[model samples]
Target: LCYFQQGSQSHSVKHYWYTSWPDHKTPDSAQPLLQLMLDVEEDRVESPGRGPVIVHCSAGIGRTGCFIATAIGCQQLKEEGVVDALSIVCQLRVDR
Candidate 1:
């Protein structure tokens, strides 16, 4: 984890690196990744005033998209008892 001031002095940034993830494929096990996402969510909840939680991969699109979709899907499953992966992907695609 690294923390530094953003452009403005009033705000700062915290970046967490998961170097274990491969460049072209998903991890063999999802537990650690899921835990990381949960940790990030917990941090967000604890710091409601903080900026957006930025998650990304080296290439910026493929793995980034997968991580985002998984996070959203997990949230949906927890809240609504179902995971609409297709909808999440579609929404992400539209947003992207």
Candidate 2:
């Protein structure tokens, strides 16, 4: 966890890691990754005023992009009954 303070206000940031994923390869199972995402989402929901989550891997492209895309897609599916993966990936690429 990281702590930041400004005047009398203080905040902390915690990092979550997924270690089952192999180097330069996809995870053996999506279940663990999905559970991790769900845990992160639960944390976000529990902390109403928390800052946006920051997700990253070594290169901040391949796995990072997939994580973000999946999270967003899940949210979209919950709210809109569909996932626009193409658009999400395109936007993530453009933003990157």
- Model 2 lDDT per residue over 1-96, tens place: 889999999999978988877659978899988999999999999998898999988888778888899999999999999999999999988998
Number of the top TM-score candidate: 2
Q: Over the stretch 36-93, how does candidate 1's per-residue lDDT look in tens digits?
A: 8888889889889787889778889987888899889989999999998899999999
- Once model 2 is optimally superposed onto the true structure by TM-score, how far is the C-alpha of residue 85 displaced, in angstroms? 1.4
Residue pairs that clash (backbone atoms under 3 angstroms), model 2? none
The clash number for model 2 is 0
Global lDDT of each model?
0.84, 0.90
